[model samples]
Target: MTDNWSEVDLVLKTMVSTCLANEKYFGDLDSVVGDGDFGYSLARGFEKLQAQYDELDRTDIGTFLKKVGMLVTSRIGGTSGPIWGTGFLRAGMTAGATTELDGATVVKMLRSAVEGIQARGQAELGDKTLLDALVPMTDAIEEALAAGATSTEVVGRAAVAARSAADATAQLVAKRGRAAYTGERSRGSVDAGATAVAVIIEQIAEVWKTRESR
Candidate 1:
């Protein structure tokens, strides 16, 4: 179980670093079918979070996440801002001032985040959006926890599931975002948002494995 704010902080920091490092890679993926700004937009938002990391509220996990969500919403540009921001906001709301998080709580928070993304973007499974990866990732986490896996093991499973799901989006038709405008042309390329989710989860899992080794 991730039972402290410091661990949560570490995960968020890793996410920020991952986004910054992959800015160009993500942008290139987006250029395939999207407006080519998904990476730029996400990196810009996370840069703000990185810049003000020390100043963020740490009263609790929920408060911290809510602040991060608000920053992402206001600082990021384009459609990516609201959809991603809503996920953080809803996850924080579900956490509700908690200081400790068990596996079940984490899964619940993830579910809430996924729902928020769906509601904000009017997206669903098979939409070829980030949801394609995120939903499967969450399910893998839940399953890993149910099977009595360690936190690192659960994250590893999630990373695999997210990557597989993201890759599968290459076979799907874009049904959301600017990619949808491409019609059949979008079928061969993977969704940038989904790929980003997979990359992020993979980074998290890698970080967790290193931490466990230490």
Candidate 2:
């Protein structure tokens, strides 16, 4: 089944709640390697986005997603602003005017987002950045979709993969972002960015599951 704008709205709400609740954890993760502002930045940004959520155009997914990108970029601070902004912006463009998304469509959108993040961040798979989580998540989504899984199933599988990737970051020496400055010391601590990515992906999956249950 195709997913609607209402589902997108629910996903955003879930993300806002998830980010706010885990803000301190994200900050703690970042404090070990970076500026310790990752959680606060996401909380502040998503809260602002939530405030204007009702005003967003719900007719077209592309327009809605583009608005989200602009809001995050303008309201958030640090490297996360541009990286997430570019990712959402590219995903929106890839989605075009679609009002509903299917398994294949979601995969395409995620792939575009991953590519955009890579272009903006210049990060690779093992960089211990959000890409470390997002890339594998997208790969899993694509695989699930190819196997004829529903959109919900695709996202569920992807979220699990993303979480695993985020956890795996603990063993990697960061090669990008502020964490890179720690050299080998970055190992043993999860990348805050990757954790954020996994958390958001899990939130999306939760929203979908909740919707399906209802």
Candidate 3:
């Protein structure tokens, strides 16, 4: 992939792609428990973000990310939009407007992103939202970085953590969002947001590993 992104941009790209891909996933799954419009809303929001990416050259990473956040929250009707949007913005902010991100910075950025999501959504780790995956994944990144793992290694471990966390969320009863309406019934289902988070982070870490090998 010739589209190289710095720390913030790497995350931004992930958001854009995950939202787009989730349009289908959300449509298919949301039909089961919630409105099918989740896909349409996510598609429109990310499509608008496609235009914002062109402005990247004209702005700093943090500014660009915040703009994306604002646009997503403003356009998309669902909780997913605001949650992911704010997560990206907070991550960029944590990186301190830098152009490059090493292991430590990326770890901090991930943690900040998770905090942002929690602050905005008021969802805890067991809420069966994206936080279920993101918090644990970022926690792994932080611990890996503290142990002197390379950026690639930290991200790889984080991706694995994210996936496992996402899977684990299936056994949890939802305490937030529409899924919460299902009460105990939500326990066997995977959260759309958490699955999307794991997918994107896995892709990112995979790319990082491939880049390192090359």
Each model's lDDT comes to 0.93, 0.87, 0.75
The reply for model 1, stretches above 4 Å from the true place, is none
Better of 2 and 3 by lDDT: 2
CA deviation > 4 Å runs, candidate 2: none
Error of 3 at 146 (Å): 1.8
Model 3 score (lDDT): 0.75
Q: Write down the TM-score of every candidate.
A: 0.98, 0.94, 0.86
Reference-based TM-score, model 2: 0.94
lDDT per residue as tens, model 2, 1-214: 3566776767678888899899899999999989899899988888898899889776699988998999989978898889988887988898889898876777788789988888899988898899899889989988887888876798799899999999999999999888899899999999898889898889889888977788
Clashing pairs in 2: none
lDDT of 2 at 172: 97
Please report, as a residue range, the 10-residue window in candidate 3 with the lowest summed lDDT. 1-10
Indicate which candidate wins on TM-score.
1
Best by lDDT: 1
Ranking, lDDT, top scorer first: 1, 2, 3
lDDT of 1 by residue, 1-60 (tens): 688876797789999999999999999999999899989999999999999988989888
